[model samples]
Structures are given as structure tokens and as C-alpha cells.
Target: MAGNSDPLTPRAKIAVTAGKAVAAASRAAGRGSGSVIGGRVALKLDPDLLARLAQNLDVVLVSATNGKTTTTRLIAEALRAAGPVVSNALGANMPAGITSALAGGSEARYGVIEVDEKYLAGVARDTDPKCIALLNLSRDQLDRAAETRMLAENWREGLAGSKAVVVANADDPLVVWAASSSPNVVWVAAGQMWKDDAWSCPSCGGVMQRPGDDWFCGECGFRRPQPSWALSGDHVLDPHGSAWPIRLQLPGRANKANAASSAAVAAVFGVPPQVALERMYQVQAVAGRYDVVQFMDRDLRLLLAKNPAGWLETFSLIDPAPAPVILSVNARGADGTDTSWLWDVDYTRLTGHPIFVVGDRKLDLAVRLEVANQHFQVCENVDQAVQLCPPGRIEVIANYTAFQDLRRRVGN
Candidate 1:
């Protein structure tokens, strides 16, 4: 908890108390972190708990297919240059989990929220955030989370009705279309590696004209906005063309882009660019992503990639050729039940790596790899997988639940 400037109503206080108690109990029982269950109980007791907790706090909502969690964490740290900040969600991101996070940090000056794409509209309506960062929209968890277009439409309608300043990616058509309806949008030239989902224009259903990283719609004439802020190599360029270097402890170009977007959002909060970037550089990992842990006498660097878009980025993060890379997956509800997304990834890009497959759905992944002619061994878990690989550092990339399973086992 941060402060006591705004007091909760009696009913809301009771809800918060009960929710924290339940969360603590759940943690003790090892059922999970209790973020979801505790917030669920709190909401059951007081339906207005979320709204009540959000009051008096400047909130920043971050939604994207791949980097929402990392972006949210980065935004929180960047805002800390202004004051005490509490992030809304990490692993838990729905209404319930968000409520729990708000309750836990009742008096923080800011709430940097990692919102699930499907729930962004409702969550945004509830929080009435000061700013919203609309990262790229792609086909993720399609079986349950709806298609990317539907989520875009939802965001379009929601942003059209809100007063929040939108910081959006200019490279993603779906995201651009969604944020276009907003009154105040700060477009940023954040790179988007996965272009599979943005082939058609959302405005007129015209075939999108994408030449290299540039894009346009021939029918409706909608195109990427002239970004006021853009990224040049490892530096972030402001509206005035002043470039600020971004130094992050996190790995990959994807993370550097995340830092750029976070700094843009923090600028709306009155934090200076250098201050924001410096604070963001302090963040080593988000949740368990990009975490390196010692396991079974081998260093396991954990990475998470659930969809084709995320996989494209993950492929670039691993060590160069012949490094042992373990790919794990699961069909649990947390991960969309269908394993069909496995076929969407260009597994041939990993041709030279010594790959291994694990998790409940390893066989499905093995079959996918077989078609691509990528050689890999099947192991029961990280322990067995690491035992077979040469001693030193090994990379592990897993889907949602499989990542969580290994993260929990490794004591993250």
C-alpha cells in the first residue's frame, strides 16, 4: 500500500480486507498467487470495488497481443520517476486480478495496468485512465480471445468515447485503425515484426499495401500516421527530433521497442524522457520473461512465446545457432486450448539450434517441427531436457501455462 490520501468506503474496505485475506490464504495453500480468486471474492462482496480503488490514482492501461505485461511493468517503473507507482497486473490481468492489484496498492499515485486485449474496453471504461498505450494487435488465443479485428473494433468504439490520450504504434494497421477514432493520439513508430495479421485495411476491407515496413490502404487512403515520436536504432526520437538513448537490462529489440513505448506514455505523465528511460533501464525482467535461472546445473534462460507474432520475436532473442533451445507448450485454458497455432510459426528459422520439446503438448509441437525438418529431442521436463544438453546456458521458450509451470518449479 502506498498512502492514505483517498479512503475507501466502508463496503469497499470490507471487500478489500476479505480479498487480501483470501489472497494471503491462497498463497499459503500454494494454490496460486491468489490474485484472481481474491479479487473475485472482493468483487462478489462489492461490485464497485475496482472503480472505488481506481479513484484518485492516475492509471495507464497497456494492451497488446505480445508485450502488454512487459510494457505495463516498464510503464510502472518509468512513472516512478514522477512518484510511487503500482502496476495493475503482471501474470494476472483480468478484472479480478486488476482489482486485487489495486487493492494491494490502494494509495499509489499511479496504476500502470496490463490489460488483456479482450477485456480492454471494459477495463478502460472502469479505470478512466489518464493514458492508454495501444500496442500491436495480432491473432492471439484466437479460439477464445476473438479475432484481432473484433478486438480492434472494440478498442475503436471504446477510444472514440474516452478522453484518454492514446499512445499507439504506427506500424500496426489494426492498432492504427483502432486508435484513429480517439481524439488525442500520440503515434510512435514502434517496429512490428509480425505482419501476418495486418494484410487488410480495417477501414474499407481493401488489400493493405505493405512495402517493407511501410503500409497504406489503397481504397480508403488510410495509412500509417506521421509519428511525433519514433525509434532510431537503440535511441528514441522525440517530436522535436531530439534522440534519447535507451539502455535496458532486458534483452532483444522487442524489449527496446517496449521501452520506447513506455517512455512515450510516461511523458504524458510529466516525467522527463531521460528520467523515464533511466527508470525503465532498472527493470531486469517482467514476471518471468527473460529470466535466467540455474536449473539442474545448467543455466536456463526462460522466454515465453504463445503465438506466431510472439514466436517471431522470441526467435531473435535466443543465442545464435547450435545453442540448446527448449520449446515447451500446453493446451490449457490459460493458453488457448487449440494447438493449431503451432503450424503458423516458421520453425525452419530455428534450423541450426539443438532444440528440445517438453510440456503436455510436446508431441503436437514435435509433429510441427517434423514437417519443418527441424531436429529436436523430446524431454519430460526441464530437468531431463537440460541433462541431455551440453553444460552452460540453454534457452527455454514456452507458451503461457507451460512457461508458468516451469517458472513455478524453478521458484520464480
Candidate 2:
């Protein structure tokens, strides 16, 4: 219910009131997420609703093909040291979702937003964020986001002439190219675990060569930008070569990279590096990415993997032992219909581990696993699948819709 107290035009005030009522009704009826529908209605009534809401707020936008939600949460949490901050904690990254969050937290002085990759340009132009964090880019929803290169090109053009300082991943060549036009940039060596998408230089279309931590293109003379911030093992290295140990509740190197990226963004706002790292350590889960839920007779740790890069990172977080893992995938609207990206994932990483396949596309996953010589069992239902595993903690990795469904069922 917190929002801007400033006087609004009669029409704009009416639109806000109507949107609030719709959001409340949607929450009451449980028909949908309510985040988008209300915003959709408000935008229809006032096309400039988002821009108005963003007028006086200091905004920090986080966008990437993957990890946008988690990274956004990290940055928002760190910004709490300054004062009250507004953010979309429900995994809403599109314009509608952003509109709802800005409207709800209108009075807050600072905003941390997770923006969809394809809509980054428009959102950046609308909000005029103080700092825009470019994490990494890769093929996400081929059905929706046709090409990563196109997204980078759009970002390059979108950020042009903006006064916002850019915080970009130096290890990601695509990110480097995308934020190249920004006048002010802070580069961080947040590790790029997935390189398949950036094998070719986006600038000159030449094959890129990686020697150690640096990458360069023979054809374009484009190379990895030197990072001002970087993560070394369990510590963060600053431009001055000082190291600070980072403690995080989230597992995996990717999450550490996310923390580094957030720390860099926080520094832009004058937040101490130690304070930012400490704040990030307190974040246990984002939406349901790494939440552990008890279902039936077992504890299920939920991990969301929508594409090959995501799967790769999630797989590394799993214990090397032969523990039972459940994988669910759906071709619903939220999850891209084309599941061919499954072929790109290295399923062999779980070669000896036990896997339980579930969801509408369980058969597809089963075939992929079989091709990799990995043993797996098909369970159409997640609740039923948990019963097959030993009575302990189990790992559940699912795509977009399937993950959300499991979170709903488990009351997470």
C-alpha cells in the first residue's frame, strides 16, 4: 500500500486506484500472480504510469539471460543499509511487473529491479536508473528471445546517452559489447561459467580465444575488459588488491559471482564492500530458486534450470555423491516450447548420480539422459517421485512452469 504521496492528475490517480483494486481482487481470488494484470490495466489507462512512478526514485536495474532474479535480490538487500528500498521480490521482470513494483513502493527513495533481458533497453530508458548491472547473456527463450546478439545490440543502443553508470561483467564478452557505449562503466570479473554463447565475438563475428582469465578476438581486436572488482576463491578482490572474505548462504561459484556483481553495484552507491557482502550472506532463497521444502516424506531442495547454462551451474552445486535428483520440465507459455536446448546441456556431468525425471517433457529428458549413458527413472508426478527416493534430502531441478508449480504445491 506504500506509494508516492505526491498529487497526481485526476486520470492518473483513478488509474492507480483501479489497479490497486484489481490487484487486491486477483490476490483474493487466486486466479493469477496479480503482479502483471494490475500493471497491465494501469498502463492501458496511463501509458506513462511507470515513468511517473520512477520520477524521484534512485533505481538500480539488474538484467541478464540468467540469474537476474537472484542478483536483483542481492543488490536490493545490500541497498537496505542506505534506507527503505523497493523491489519486485516475486520474480516479475517485465514492464508490467516493474510497473506494479514501482507503484506499490512509490514512496521508497531507492528501487532495485529485475528487468527482462529483451526489455532492458526500454526499462532503462524509462526508469533512468542510477546504475544498470549487466550480468551475462546467452540463448534463453529462443521462442521469445530470438537471439542474444540482438539483445546485446539493443542494449548497446538503449544505454546510449543515458547518464546511468553501467556495472558489467568483464568476463562475459557479450556483456562487454553490450555496455560498450555507456559513458561510465564499472567492470567486474564475475566468473562466466558458460562460454558456449560467447564463443564468437559479438563485435566482429570472429572466434574468440581464451587464455587464462582473458579473452580476445583476432579479427576485431576486442578483448576482455579489465575488471575493477573480482572474486578470488572465498574472497572479493578490489581494485586496490585488498581482499575481503565473503560468506554466502547460497551455494556454487555462480552465486559468488552474483555477489561480486552486486557488491560492485553497491559500491557505485557508496555502500562499503564488506557491508554489501554481509547483507548478501543473509539471503537464503530468492523466490524459490534454492528453497528447501518438505513434501511427502522427504526434504526437497528446489533448483531452477531453464537453459543449458542454468543447468550447468545448478549441476555443479549438487553433491558429487549418488543422491536422488528430480528434474521437471514443461513446454508451457512461461517455459519456451522448444526444449531442444536440453541437447546442449552436459547431462554426462551427472553420469553416476541417480536422477528422477518428471513433468510433461519427462520422456524427452529420459531420452537425453539415456543417450549420455546416465541412469534415470521416469515419474510423471513430483509428489510421487519424491516417494521413490531415499528418506532424506532430495534435489529437484525444474524449468520455469514446473518450478513454480512445485513451489506452489510445497507452500514455499
Candidate 3:
């Protein structure tokens, strides 16, 4: 009821109303927000409302710079094997947004909410999580966030005294170092993509050595042992619950890491390994994050690429599949204020001719595509872009705003 005049409400009624209107318009044009209610924009939380939500619940809080959406969704899916589980099905990661999800899940016994790094401390302060999963830290939204070091330091400080079982990714030196600070930690490591991004110890800036998936500083000897939960494989294990001797339908090497992280959580929750693995293959991508939509009788694999890291992994997914692609970019603030990160993405995986570029900022992406020495076609609008592609199978790499636009273009 605190829609219009609620001063303390973080989101104004006008903003929420406009968001709803936009969502409605997008759906009418084709794309759905999944929930028929559309932008169910729930932000401002009264003290009474907050207190009510915190009454009695065991919450699993998953926070990360990247991968939380897919990982959290995977955890929820795996947990479902045991009993009814509730989560922010729409990837609402902020406190107010999570509050909305909790309000919606009236009957859920287990609550899984993916928390954004900036809001993790505030949300955790209010509701102590039963288990906290911390994924890797990477450079993302530099405009909104400080360097990864600063953000990781804050996470280290904020989570100092929490009782929640800390589940962390150990492959990343920063994440591994953070877990070392906590006594009760469930570390997850991957020797799968064990390529060295870190040369020296994070603590002393000295050369580090990896002796059997265990990284330690040569000078300071700062080390975090191998994770209790480890995933060893040639390729990052795909979570799509695979049948005997076969992987699931989703594509991407990063998704294997995603599934591994979720599998660790399932282990913590006492879900059988076989059951967890089964659920992972069955788990699908959250809407807009590698979601495949059947549009105009053509299949469009929508990969939401918001950051450099996401784009990098998504590029790998597109490499093996010999499908024509539509690389969409948008300059809207919601998508990103600066599209300069396009430089950081490795587009070498993309090998083909006349890649279609769609977006309000089609010219910008067209310029980049051209520089890559690849065939390029610029579309004034998304509808025309999708029209150019043959029906049945096509790939779309979209940023946030472009995702909505892309959905509508494909007649979502």
C-alpha cells in the first residue's frame, strides 16, 4: 500500500509505475517478464514488513560479482529434489527486491535469494543467512563498483562474524583468500579452468605456486588448501542433469563452474550427489541468461551478456555451435552507461560472415564487429535484425536493455 507517498520507500511510485508500464509494453510487443504481473516493482520496505519477514526462516544467501543468477537457480532446482523450495525466481538480488520474492513465496520452507555484492552486507545484517555461497570476484560495472579488491575487502569485513556456513569458490585467489579468513568454510575449487590469472599471492604480491590445485605464495607462503568440495574434469561439468554418459542441453564452459558451485550447496543441504547432478542437467538458464526462445518459428538462444566475464564465457559457448549470431548492444543506463567493455570481450571464438548487429546502438557494435575483420550487418531495429536470420536456430548476445528489446524483436 506504500505506493505513492511513502517517503522512505527507495523506489517512487512513478518509477515503479513506469517500470510496470514498460514491462507491459514489452510483453504486448512479444517479450514477457515470465511473471504475468510484469515489473512487480517492490522496493521500499517498512520496518514492520522487514521484521515480519525475518520471523522464522532458513535462508541461503548467494552473492557474487558474476554467476550468482545461474548458480542460485541451479541450487534451487537441485534442492527441489528433497522438498518444496522457494527462491526469487526472477533473479531479484537486492534487499528490497528479495523482500518482494519472500512476500510472494508464502509457503516456502527453504528460501534461496541471490544477493548483489553492494547490498549483501545490508541484507545479511537484517537476516542472517543459514548458508552463504560466495562466487568469484571479477571486474564488472566499474562505473558503479570500485575495483574487485575493494569489493572483496568489504565482503571479507562484512562477513567476519556470521554463523552461516560460508560456501566459496576457491579457484579464484581472491575468493580463496576471503574464505581463509573464516573458520567455518566450505571451499569449492576447480582445476578445470585452472589457467593462472593470478601470478603472485594476493596477500604479499609475491610469486605463487600451484602444487596440485593448491595455490600458495612462494615468499609469504600464504595459502588456502584444496576445497572440501572439488570438481575435477576435462571440461567444466555441465549441470544440466545428464543421462548416463551424456551432458544436458545447455551450452557453455562457465556453466560447468556454475553447476559445480550449485552442487556444493546441494551437498551442504544433504542432497545426494546423484540427485544433485541429475537436477543440474535439468536446470535451465534464468530468463534472458542463455534462455532459448522459439520466435517466428526460429529458435533464438538469448545469452544475456552484461559484463566482460559473462561475454567471454558466452563467446566460448557460441564457438562450437556453427550457428549465425546476432550480437546486440544497447547503451541504456540499465544495460550499461559505457559499452567500452566490448574491447575486453574475446570475440575470436566468433568465426563467420556478416554477423548481424542489432540494438538502438547498432552502429557502435557494427564498428567493433567491423574492426574484428568479420562480416557485419547493422539493423536499425531488432525486428528487422531477427527477420534477417533464418528461422529455427540463431544466437543472440544481448546486454540488459537489449535483452528486452531482443525478446520483442524475436516476437517473444
Top lDDT: which candidate number?
1
What tens-digit string does per-residue lDDT give for candidate 1 at 259-344?
Answer: 88988998999997899999888888878789999987889999999899999999998899889999999999989898898899
How many residue pairs clash (N, CA or C atoms closer than 3 angstroms) in each of the candidate models, in the order given? 0, 0, 9
- Candidate RMSDs in Å, in order, are 1.8, 2.0, 6.4
Report lDDT (Cα) of residue 212, candidate 2.
84
True-structure lDDT of candidate 2: 0.88
lDDT tens digits, residue span 37-81, model 3: 332443331433433454355678888877788778888888888
- What are the models' TM-scores? 0.97, 0.97, 0.81
When summed lDDT is taken over every stretch of 10 residues in candidate 1, the lowest stretch is 1-10
| TM-score for candidate 3, residues paired by index | 0.81
The runs of at least 3 residues in candidate 1 whose Cα sits more than 4 Å from the true structure, single-residue gaps closed, are 1-7
Q: Could you tell me the TM-score of candidate 1? A: 0.97
What's the lDDT for candidate 1? 0.89
Off by over 4 Å in 2: 1-7
